[model samples]
Target chain A: MSAPRPVYDPSWDRANPNEVRRSIRERGYTGYTAGLAPGFVQANICILPKDWAEDFLLFCQRNPKPCPLLTRSDVGDPSLPALSDNIDIRTDVPRYQIFRNGEFTEEVTDIRSHWRDDLVTFAFGCSFSFEEALQDDGIPLRFLANNNVAGVYVSTMPTEAAGPFEAPLIVTMRSFTPQNAIRAIQITSRFPNVHGAPVHIGDPAQIGVDLAKRYQNVGDPTVGEGEIPVFWACGLTPQFAVMKAKPPFCITHAPSSMLVTDLRNSSLAVM
Target chain B: MSAPRPVYDPSWDRANPNEVRRSIRERGYTGYTAGLAPGFVQANICILPKDWAEDFLLFCQRNPKPCPLLTRSDVGDPSLPALSDNIDIRTDVPRYQIFRNGEFTEEVTDIRSHWRDDLVTFAFGCSFSFEEALQDDGIPLRFLANNNVAGVYVSTMPTEAAGPFEAPLIVTMRSFTPQNAIRAIQITSRFPNVHGAPVHIGDPAQIGVDLAKRYQNVGDPTVGEGEIPVFWACGLTPQFAVMKAKPPFCITHAPSSMLVTDLRNSSLAVM
Candidate 1:
């Protein structure tokens, strides 16, 4: 209750993605898109050259839990008609991370100047949909309350592979009272496109996670009393595989800044 | 796998509850009803005098988590037309425990000799329906595989009161690998009548049950490695309440013995 209240606009006002993108496009706004477009789905963007697209698609297919693909663009297509009519992959996201030869290069506000033909845009569902779902159900997630990312941990469970795109699954952990934990499972399970259910719960060590200390490179958890740690496949999983597979050129959403989609959060539910 | 398999007609020879009930009534079958009614719903039986029925109904209405009432029969009616056309209150159940002033009196194959014109029957959903739902979803409940009843524990949670029916919640525990436990939560959640999802999960001590100790009067839990214990509201709640209240007369199915019904468990799913 003491946290800064998220600002919401009832009409297609300042909070709308289209309007937010216009602000970002003009360099008027360049910040994390966490609370913007609150009820709509925000996607993790991964743009790769056409040659590496097929391999990544194969990887996603093999590891749906970690890389739940929402939509894929045709080759050289900067516009993602399937995701939103007005979506321009080059400029829609608040910020973009440019990677070259599998290494972190630089972060940019817009990618239109770096855009090219033979580029394939991917929009993978993120944890935001399920996080919103959990909050709506009155299940308190600790990180959101703390205004920090949920605890991220590397697990021993290996992801299914498509050629070189193989890595241990990366997961986000959240501890909850057993009752709320059950409700969290039931709620998140309905949205499989957004990592769905959970990959593991209870003892972190069972999944090869070091509970006393996190991976340190990523998030660490604080497991509380009467609560159990629940894990969900993380979107970072694709980044790990993509880095290992190292296509000549790749683009992804800047950490915590995602591409807002026209699709409603409720629309992602498989049930 | 080494556990004794409960009687089941694999080809669905025991598809209908009526057929199964007929077999039981004719002495063609006298085993437990655990696997007999396969897809159909099975219920917990509670027969009380007309004077006690109203309070009991209110108790059930107040404590739906434990006593999810499926149907109630008219005074002294042997047939619960809603559950099955030929269901006889006196002989359908394989065995019955008759209670006098809430004291354990004796067990009988049939209660015809004890039947009273003033007696009314209350049928409540049993966990068998949701357990079958869980198994259908490929979630293995180890207790079932071990050929034992679920681990029953008395919880600190209290049911809402109606007249003299007030007691601590009784829950049946099922342990699952963290992954399957989440799946179990999703599958059973859709069927609120069968106790609905779980009342508690993770550490048992939170619910007032000391993990190292077995319940005061129930079976031992067989929790194994990398598994989390999940607890569901048990039908035994009402029986405990009745015993505490010391009703003038009562009759219930012998533990592990249930009354088979014509309704499929799927039909009770709210979603």
Candidate 2:
């Protein structure tokens, strides 16, 4: 059996984000990036042909909470100058998932060979920014201790469609005591660029979310007794929409692997 | 026998705050100030003898959410220049409740006859400002239609004490659909001076509150089916603490009657 994945290392908390990106580009750090570069913003990356990029941009504008657009690269340009100067999207991301007609085709560390002249890159904000804010405020996140990500689910709520992009809004669920949940709502509300506040709290059934059946069973979904489940609009929402839209060719960062950026998490706070 | 309390009038939405206060000062309006001067901030008033005022101020400082101090009157001075150029605490409030040795003794239309040189007036932020925000955002408040105020409850949470000023935290509970509740939390968070966001949500028993048993059975305490109850730190908390401290003399605005101010509710938004 493959060696068990490594637990978060405390030293990663102090690592420079650019150094971490270099490691990711060099294939020296292929693991998921949870604890590394604690203060910087990490993004959900999606690359699609220019023809499909227009509709995706409208989709993000229509549903900001689910797809908070951080920056969009120019057509056929690999660098997102707004996020970083030295970055090259194709080689900087730790892993890339290739999709063919809405079906996952393969996973690779670098997409240099698959890069296209007609491609456009979109970087959407991720939850790690607000999660760091929550932790900084002393709100405990139990899932982090177990090396598990938040529970992901497809909610009954429908997204405002844009062209061919239409799908159920996907959400990430985290549980907290009623007190901390209120605090989490306040803390997250400050970062409107990063999912900004929860979409639902309390009864999961109200949103048609079954706590026992997380989407793809990607993480620990168990909510302890006395803890209330809070749900935030997830970054996976755009990918789910991509699956439904069935663009001829598409690429996304692998789950749990994200595009590290030079933007400070605090800089994202609108307040 | 009370000539059926008047329902909210639409014209009050356009009434000038200072003009409305003038009517209150002249006894033309002796009714509750709920809908009058719609966009203005109305304050909860508390007057205490100089000896007890110091400790009461300390109590408010220690428990800001429940008793957000808007302005404090100079000892023996009736004017609050910070709130308005012409505000006279003794005459501006529509009604006042007099307490002797912590027991409410009488309610009167005016407190000018009882003014003293050693008396100090304290004005606090009220939930009405935030309520107006919630309504403006299209969050329907069912209790307002029935002319019922939020349920008042004595929670298990205790307040930090100063001198003899100590009591259980008094909370005002309102019920909303989960969706509106999230919006309410966000809207209220913008007005920190007005009790801020909710202290607790969901299961009431977790905070030792029984839905059927409200403090003194004031207002309607019902939680409708499928609606979630959100509890906010109430301005009544300081009054409760005053009752517990048993100071020789105290004065507060009668329930539902408040001091009108020239400050617009929008000015209170921190963000």
Candidate 3:
């Protein structure tokens, strides 16, 4: 059998988010969506059983920067007409990670066979929108230059709980010169729905992340001298909480793989 | 004599700028206005013969940050009805520095005897307003704690010439931690009338001031390690240019002595 094409290849970069979602639903494309959907908002996907949905919704309400909700589907509805007319929450994302009894199981290209009538879907604002805003402001982003998002991982800080939904906060770190960091703050501040201005601006230890060990288990933590590390509440923050509040059934887009929406990122700017 | 009261003390702190000006005009108080009228805007006063006024005005236009004009009196007029109701520029400021043929003469408490019908008055914004803004933003100002304004000096950069009025730029430097310096930039950026933002940030030598010697020829320079020395256009900049032009006569506020206005510092915020 022939091996499948890689997601980072040029062809995928040019593909629109809706088109990518269509292919995932039809062709079983299980790959990352980091550089996809150029100027559109990409979401952190979460599908929960009705039993756990209300609490997670409340958890997002209490901590908006990490989980700004773009749209949420009605229980067992499988569709979000507001985000995209044709979006199917059940199988539109490129890949899904199944969590059974609060633990990770095998990743799958399609989740149709596992769908339940009580599953409710939530789409959240992600950093890609504001990352686009930063570049347009003439501020250089080192990680994006190498085609990467800022580092991400769980922090020891716990999140506000709603009933059964509770977990530690997860964050993403971006490093920039003092001047550029300020510009980044102003630019990102305009996009509050996408994790507005940095939560912390200086030393990493204050936020409980080892600069030398960043998402250390998941990503790079080495920051250069004179460069300040800015931490933003991350989309993965909700996932970490979800993992802690593991219900009988939960699903998420595979890490770095998201559901691209038809909405443009500029539409997210508060100003 | 009660050993002659010191030139400046916070005891003068609560005094209103207009009250101070009225007292100085009457020769009742003849000292510096530093730290008086805490939240009010202070102005650097300049008086020039009508012949030289046009060029000096143009010079101010060319270098606005250094010579931001708050108000200008018509030729031969000392009353600035626009800036304040009971204002008489000739006798308002606590002290005045007399310049004859571009050379410093005696400092006087009142200029009424020296004032002439052919002279015009120029009021420029000083750093006191923006400094107040930084403090309000929760950015600690170290120099204020040490009872000093930012350092003063002349730079090699030449000012645009209008008539005979022309000279190199003069600036003020204040050191701040890189992070605080960035906060200072954003806060000050709102007030263009008060030397908005900074001309240059980081290494001082790049702008031609030898950090080691500074401009002690005019005033002392204070900078600390791990602190970026941010420079702003100084109100004295126009004074330097005006002196070089050397009409028959000119006058300016004495160093550290300023004319207080009824206008609050908050009145200058553009945002």
- How many collisions per candidate? 0, 0, 1
lDDT of 3 by residue, B59-140 (tens): 8888787889999899998888767888888778777888889898878778889988999999888888998888888888
User: Where does candidate 1 clash, by residue pair?
Assistant: none
TM-score of chain A of each: 0.93, 0.94, 0.91
- Weakest lDDT window of 10 consecutive positions for candidate 1 chain A: A1-10
What CA RMSD would candidate 2 show? 2.8
Each candidate's interface RMSD, rounded to one decimal?
A: 0.8, 1.0, 5.1
**Model 2 per-residue lDDT tens digits across residues B48-104:** 999998989999999999999999999999999878998988888877889999998
Question: DockQ values for all predictions?
Answer: 0.78, 0.78, 0.16
Between candidates 2 and 3, the one scoring higher on DockQ is 2
| lDDT tens readout by residue for model 1, A106-144 | 888789889999899989999999999999988887778
lDDT of residue A98 for candidate 2: 96
Candidate whose TM-score is highest = 2
lDDT of candidates 1 onward, in order:
0.84, 0.88, 0.77
- Model 3 lDDT per residue over A1-271, tens place: 1223445544443458677777777766766666666898888889999888888889999988888888889989988887889888778887788998889887877888999899999999988899888888877777777755678766666677788767667888887765576567667777888988666666556557775665535554546666667778888778877877768889988877789888999999976
Task: Quote model 2's TM-score.
Answer: 0.94
Off by over 4 Å in 1: A1-12, A215-217, B1-16, B28-30, B211-217
Angstrom error of the Cα, residue B87, model 3: value is: 3.7
Scored against the true structure, residue A129 in model 3 reaches a CA lDDT of: 93
lDDT of 2: 0.88
